[model samples]
Target: MNDAFGKRVRRLRLDRDWSQQELSLRSGISTPHISSIERGKRFPSLEYAKRIADALGVALVALCDDASELRSPKMRGSAEELPLYLQNFVLNEEATPYLEVAHQMSQLPKEDADLLSLVIGLLVKRRYETPVLTP
Candidate 1:
């Protein structure tokens, strides 16, 4: 599969706390095959992709979606939209505490928003803790 497809599968599997072996068992695919797919060394047929998506409890299209599209310029750098974007990121990272802080930060005066730095620090920490799996 394409790199984006591989990344999406890896992300979904990680989100579900499944190791490659676990996913392979659930999908009826081999562990080595799943690893190859995640590494973008091999592409699954459409039927296999569907099975994998079903095993992950996600729609097939979700596995095909390009996450980078969400990071387009229009989605970045607007003060009014930043909190919403940050909340989504934190939620996807399973950092609910940081999501709550982001919500609270939106209500703070600009001068009192230094705590935003804390939110960033938390996200950075989480990123390092669970490095993105790149294909």
Candidate 2:
């Protein structure tokens, strides 16, 4: 079931210039365990997959195209070319006001700009916040 997923994990690890030992140390997963999983001789639990994915700087879905890959509502692609659905969501009305506010605050002092960006990021992530533009 996880054969392809194991291959993907290996590919991403090498892509990031990490050896199994490095990944193991960073992810707190043992090196032998990472090796077995990468070889498709073992399957990681959901939690371990998450820790590995985070350490690899990838979405867990990148590891598996299967149903067990949990979808995170807050996940945003770092890739330049996103799928059509993500493109549409980024263009939607809900994102417009926030984008406008972010653009307007871009010229502020670095500290002030960062603070405003954090607040805006929080509002965007919470999704239920009243979109009040605060300077």
Q: Assess the local accuracy of residue 96 in candidate 2 as a C-alpha lDDT between 0 and 100.
A: 81
Error of 1 at 40 (Å): 0.6
Q: Model 2: per-residue lDDT, tens digit, 97-130?
A: 8655654464345699789779878978887666
Best candidate according to TM-score: 2
Q: Candidate 2: lDDT over CA atoms? A: 0.72
Models 1 onward score TM values of: 0.49, 0.50
> Model 2, 65: alpha-carbon shift in Å?
0.7
27-79, model 1: which lDDT tens digit per residue?
99999999989989998999999898766655566677665321111112223
- Model 1 Cα shift for residue 69 (angstroms): 9.3
The segments of candidate 2 whose C-alpha lies over 4 angstroms from its true place after superposition are 66-135
Worst 10 residues of 1 by lDDT: 69-78
lDDT (C-alpha, whole model) for all candidates: 0.71, 0.72
